[model samples]
Structures are given as structure tokens and as C-alpha cells.
Target: MDATLFSLYFSALVAVYLLPGPDMALVVATGASRGVRMALVTSLGIALSRGMHVFMSGLGLAALMAAHPVLLDVVRWGGAAYLLFLAWQVLRADMRVDTTQGAEGSAASGFTRGLLTNLLNPKALMFCGLFLPQFVAPERGPVLLQFVWLGAILVAVGFAFDAIYAVLAARLSRRVRSASPFRKWLLPTVFVLLAGRLVAS
Candidate 1:
């Protein structure tokens, strides 16, 4: 990649990562509710999903989805439904009590939630398809190689941001009382809002 183009791409990536989105909301919620370990696991799941999106983009799945609007709607509705399910889970859980049956199981569920949350969103895949191509330069190297490099960078930067948010949220949660209504309701509210946003979009 050309040095200047790479710099520009990096700048754009940073800007995008800084924006508050569902992924950030999910990470922060998980951190605040369950603690840093679960949040980190969630972030890892999201990173894996992002990597898969990049791979699918490389295979031109984005174009396929664009050609088939029905497919996109299917993903969009599915994502929204999943978000609502997460919201329900949050609402029903008693955060004041340590009701978790097992740490390992809880972590697994968190990872699955994070992975599915991002993976089910058609917009995220479409974004990978659109954003990655803008930075690819055929003159600099093989196009596929350039895409791979760019995709790797995108996932790395995104994961870094998510990790930071997770840690900060976890630390903040420690200062607030566990019985606080705001602490209990925050994740559910965020999930519902995200679901609404996905449906609206």
C-alpha cells in the first residue's frame, strides 16, 4: 500500500471506531454488568465475527446480498430479534444476586452473544464490503493481499477500542452500587434502543 493512502485509511478507521455503536454498547454493557473478563470474551467474539465479515467481503458476498434485497432484510430482522432477546435476558436477570451457575458457561454465552450480535447485522457485512475496497490500491500490490492487510488492521483497531471501553466500563461499575436501578436497567435499555435502531435502519 502507498504510505499516504495507508495513513488516510488508518485515520478513517480510527474515526469509525471512535463512534458509539451497537458493538461499543454491547461491550460496555457486558463489562459493567458481568465484569472485565466477560467483556473481554465478548470483545473477542466480536473480533472473530468482524474477521468473518472481512473474509465474506473478500468473497464478494456483499455484492450478492445487495443484489438480493430479501436476503438483507432477513439478516436485518434476525439481528433485531436477537437484540430484543438480549434485552429480555438483561431485564429478567437479577443483577443484585450472584445467580450465575458457572463462570465458564456465562463466559461462553457472552462470547456467543457478542459474535451473533455483530454477525447477524447485514449492515456490518455491507460496511466491510464498502469500506475495505476504498483503501485497496492495485498499483501498490496484489489486490487480494492489500485487502487482507487492510482487513487485519481494521479488526485490530476495532478490538483495541472495544477492549478499552470494556475496561473503563468495568472500572466504573465498581464505583456504582450493584443495587442501583440505573445499573440494572442500563443494558436492557441499550439493547432495546439498538434493536430499534436496526429495525429503523
Candidate 2:
């Protein structure tokens, strides 16, 4: 890969990743409700999902999904349903346990939430198909290697930004711990809003 092309792609990737999106919202919301550890774990799941997207894109699955609107809708609906489940989890959490636990839900559940949130978003998959190709060079050695490298870059950038958001939201939550209702209601609200957005789209 040309150094200049990689640099340009990195710049664009940073801008794209910095924008507020589902992944960022998930990290921040999880952090605020659950604590930094859970939020970080969630980021791990999200990073891994980025790897899945890269793998899917390399296999031409993303393009295939883009070509077929029904397939994309299936994924989208599944994602929206998953988000609703998450909201239900938040709303139905044991208030006393949640207060004592400080959002330390199961790490596995957090991971699953992170994974599904990304995997379900057809836009992310489609974006992978559209975005990566712009920086790839067919004649610049093995195409698959370039795809993996670019995908890794995207994941790394996303993880870093999401982690920062998680930490910041967690810190803010700590300061506002006195705001009991906010602590109780925030995650469910965010999840519902996200689910609505997914459904609307």
C-alpha cells in the first residue's frame, strides 16, 4: 500500500469513527450505567465485530447484502430486535442489585450486546464494502492482505475512540451518582432511541 494512500485513508477513517454512532452510544451508555470495566468489555466486543465486518467484506458478503435489500432488512430487523432486548434488560434490571453492582452486568452479556449492535447494522456492513475499496489497490500486491490491514486500522481507531467515550461517560456518571433517576433510566432510553432509529431506517 502506498504510504500516501494509507495516510489519506487513515485520516478519513478517523473522521468517520469520531462521528457519534451506535457503537459510540453503546460504549458511553454502557459505561455510564455499568462502569468502566463493562464498557471496556463492550468495546472489545465491538472491535471484534469490526473484524467480522472485514471478514465478511473480504468474502464479498457485504456486497452481496448490499445487492439484496431483503437480506439487509433481515439483518437490520434482527439488530433492532436485539436492541429492544437490551432495553428490556436495562429496564428490568434489579434496582437494588444494579445500585450495588454499579452496572457490572455479565461480561458475556456486554460482549454479546457489543457484537450484535455492530453485526446487525447493515449500514456498517455496507460501509465496509464501500469504504475499504476506495483505498485498495488491485495491483498493490495481494488484495486480501491489503483488506486485512485496512480493516485492522479501522478497528484499532474505533476501539480507541470508543474507549475514550466509555471512560468519559463513566466518569460523568460517577460525578452524578446522586442523580438516581438518571442512573436508572439513561441506558434504557438510549437503547430505545437507538432501536427506534434502526427501525425507522
Candidate 3:
């Protein structure tokens, strides 16, 4: 790929990652409420989802969904429903800051939440299909190879940002009381809003 084109792609990717979205909100919320460890685990799950999305895009799954709008709607609605379910789970969770138990279990749940959140969103897969192809130069190399390289970069950059958010939120969380209403309600609110956004989209 041309250096100028690669630079432009990187810039655009960074800009997109900087935007406030459900994935970022989830990581920050998890860090604030749970701790850095769980948040990092959640980020890992999201990274895996993004990798799968890229793989699916390379296999032309996005094009298949585009050809059948109902399939897209099914995925969109499913994602929204899952987000709402997560909101409910957050609302019902015990937020008493118990460090003695359920750490392992909660971390596993967090990973699943992060994975499903992105994986079910059809827009994410479509984004990989659309955003990646724009930067591909047919004459430079194999198109699939270019996509793989770009996808890896995208996942790496996204995970880096999420890790930053997790650390910052965990630091800030230390100052607040575990019993605070903010910790109790912030995550549920974020999840609800994300669900609404998906439904509206």
C-alpha cells in the first residue's frame, strides 16, 4: 500500500475509535464498577469479536447480508435486545463491592457481554466490509492480505484505546465509595442508552 494511503487510513481509523460508542462506554463502566482486571477481560472479548467481524467480512458475509435486508434487521434487533438484557443484568447485580467472591465468574460474564455486544451488531460487520475496502489498492498486493493487515491494525488500535479507558476509569473509581449511587446506576444507564441507539439505528 502507498504510504500516503496508509497514513490516511490510520488517521481515519483513529478518528472512528475516538468517537463515543457502546463499546467504549461498556469498558469504562466496567472499569469504574468492577476493576481494571474485569475491564481488560471485557476488552479482550471485544477484540475477539472485532477479529471475527473482520474474518466474516473477508468471507463476504457483509455482502450477503446487504443483499438480504431482513438478515440485517434480524441482527440489528437481536443486538438491541441483548443490550437491553445486559442493562437489566446490571440493574439487578449486587453492587456492594465484595472482593472476596465471584471474581472469576463475573470476569467470565463480562467477557461474554463484551463479545456478544459487538458480535450481534450487524453494523460492525458492515463497517469492516465498507471501511476496509476503501483503503485497499489492488495493484499493491493481494486484496485479502491488505484486509488482514488493516483488520489487525484496527483491532490493535481499538484495544489500546479501551485499555486506556479502563485504567483511567479504575483510577477514578477508587475515589468513590462502593455504595455510591453513581456506581450502581451508571452502567445500567449506559447499557439502556446503547440499546436505544441500536434500536433507533
Which 10 consecutive positions of candidate 1 have the poorest summed lDDT? 94-103
In order of TM-score, best first, we have: 2, 1, 3
lDDT of 2 by residue, 1-201 (tens): 767887899899889988888888889888887788888998999999999998899899988987888998998899899888888977887423344444445777788889888888888888899899888888988899999999999999999998999999989988985875677677778888888998898
Which lDDT tens digits does candidate 3 get at residues 90-140? 788775444666677777888998899989988899999888888888898
> All predictions: root-mean-square deviation over Cα?
1.9, 2.3, 1.9
- State every prediction's TM-score relative to the real structure: 0.92, 0.92, 0.92
Candidate 1 on 53-169: residue-level lDDT in tens?
Answer: 999999999999999999999999999999999889878886533555677777788899899999998989999999998887677789888778888999999999999999999
TM-score of 3: 0.92
User: How many clashes (backbone atoms < 3 Å, residues ≥3 apart in a chain or on different chains) does model 1 have?
Assistant: 0
Stretches of candidate 2 exceeding 4 Å from the true structure: 95-105
In model 2, the Cα lDDT at residue 201 comes to 88
Rank by lDDT (best first): 1, 3, 2
TM for candidate 2 is 0.92
